[model samples]
Target: MSLRLHTLVHACAVVLAAGCLGATLWNGIAERGIALAFGVLVAVGELTRHNGPRVRQTAPLAAAGALAYALLGEAGGRPTHHDAAQIVTVVLAGSLLGSVPHVGRGPGPARDHLARRTLTVGFVAVCFQPLYARGTFDDWGGSAHALLLLALLSLSTLCDAVLAAALAHSRTGWPFPPVLRDELRALPGIGAAVVATGAVMALGVAVVGLWALPLLSVPLLLAQLSYRRYAAVRATYRQTITSLARATEIAGCTPAGHARRVAELSQSVGRDLGLTEPELTVLEYAALMHDIGQLSLVDPVPVGATAALPVPEQRRIALLGGAVVRQTGVDPRVAGIVERQADPHREQPLAARIVRVVNAYDEKSRTGGPGGPLTALEELRLGAGEYAPQVVESLARVLSRETRERDGLTRPGAG
Candidate 1:
């Protein structure tokens, strides 16, 4: 399922639990009803086809269910201390489950980082809640006590999610699944949630008594500042990458242009693989500069010799390409791609994979010396599994169209 849907479902669960807990306390509904409902929901989710990782990934939402059960038990006339302890236990359990790791295309590193934050916050809640209450809630009304606890837990969760997401973004350059980045980029919503929850709770406790606000606010503010600084750095890096990519296009403007065709064709393949705009920019620069290392390739044969140089020349080209990218301050992830292209046997990075595919086609098309387009196709087929499959397919399509156009066998737009 989409990450948006997943997060929305969790948010809904929190709200619904709050409403049910409120109703049970005020109207004296059997607290068992809320407990049963939550139990059924958890059981259904567990028995569903989802794997362990997804269930664990979403365990934070289960805390809402836990809160509801505790509130209901107290409202149904159970002892206050008993239900509060249950609430603390269940919330901690839920937080622990969230800390369990999951595997997927969604950024696992970022998720693990967030999970650690949640666990830390959960621990704080378990340790501090009892001290904060100091047995004062034993005789308090069930409704008021439940509201206070719910507000505190929600605020704590918000703090963890906000801080974790910001730190993860700085480290991973985006949140897991991309949608999370968009959500995190809208961090004012998190701030509003904290402020609103605190404001509502302040009606009972003095605004000054909400010590969690000021304590958590400092970290949240720092996270926001860090996120902004990272964004600024990324923006400047993006401009440099774009300028370099455009510079490659200007290097040679003949009919068989250098970087533009490679970039356009590389982008077409990258699009097929669901890469983002920023990823495309990185791919373009990497592709355009793939041959920068070739500038260092020296002819093994003397000027009088007509024989082509050996594989060592290709190795030299790849090494030079890596040097150029490193000099430009490209991220290690991108630089690794340029460097690995030297050894075709090595796993090529996605960016380099695309560049290599198009570069081969362009070389064959321009040289047109021996096997022509067929020679290029054969070379790609030989390295099929070594290259990204989608990139190879894009090269084939581009070549077929170019050939058909040349032979008057197809129109410009014909595929």
Candidate 2:
């Protein structure tokens, strides 16, 4: 199924390339100087692509460059003559050329990246190229023209976000709303930079010619550096929390990998419950450190099965964990969830309820035997007074889906 989807995107690009390349060839490449400039801009952008960490958009410069070409109206007091097809051809050619050096690094994901870039640039060109060529914006002054370009870029941004989110949802099987919500939330930062860069390039070039590319790129470059720093700090912070979570294991207060299992399962359950990306992060942190309080106990619970402990004891440990989390400087929200996890379901927030349900599920499942998953799920359902029914049902569905996926993979002809 994944292969088929990639094939479809590739096939669509093939059709788009064919039509655009054919038209560009027929048109004999109007404004060769301008085309060459933007092409090189995009290539340079791609050449500097960051691979350090996962991000919504890896090559903001390339995207802004391509978009600038799509929205370009005039170069140094002279208007452009290329059509939308020519714009796509130029951008695609530049991207393929730029990617050649990275080919040895396994450029498989490049296909998807190129697909997104191609579609977005082509959309803007189709909308703006013909209109600009026909004098649609000729009467509009510089201010109006800039505003128009920005508005068009905003629409293009929305379409790109939708495409990215849909592709992510298909590939990961995560719920679409939260995936899209994450994509949209990520947009206002670098996404805005890309939009602004594209618009600025187009508008500035209309007056000052190609020189604007270098002059206008400084702020965007600063923004990119700032974003990279922010990503690094976040990675470091999460690592700190993960290391903290592992302390309980180091002290022999819990089974090996118990915190990790709880974190992963709780996150999956949180996604199934339609929590946004940020909400999921808090849930994950709380789950990882949920057992940290066990370290405070003079003697750990047998096998570290807190779910099987008495409620009052569980509450005491939860409070201790929350206190530890607070002192360690993790998000206070995470601490709140940990502190509230032992509360009755009705009294707990949604994240606390989810953590409580999934933590209990993990503990019960591990001890239930070969039929552990089913038995644990049944046990969770039976303890209806303590567990949130919605969360338990959501966990059951997630487990059931995972079981099906696992079974299918183990069957013959599975990849």
What lDDT does the true structure give each of the candidates?
A: 0.48, 0.87
- Per-residue accuracy of model 1 over 189-261 as CA lDDT, tens digit each: 4334333333333232222232322343344345434544665676677667656655433443222355567
TM-scores for all candidates: the values are 0.38, 0.92
Per-residue error at 300 for model 2, in Å?
1.0
The count of residue-pair clashes in candidate 1 stands at 1
Clashes of each: 1, 0
* Model 1 ranges with Cα > 4 A deviation: 1-223, 253-288, 294-314, 346-351, 358-415
Q: Tens digits of per-residue lDDT for model 2 on 1-415?
A: 3464556766787789889999988879998999999999888777767665358888888889999999988899887788899999999988887777777676623567888888888899999988887887879996888899999999999988988877766655678898888889988988999999999999899899999998887787778778888988988999999999999999888889989998988988888878988898899899999988888999888888898898999999999999999999888999999998789999999999988988888888888889888898999999999999999998888887788789878999997
TM-score of 1: 0.38
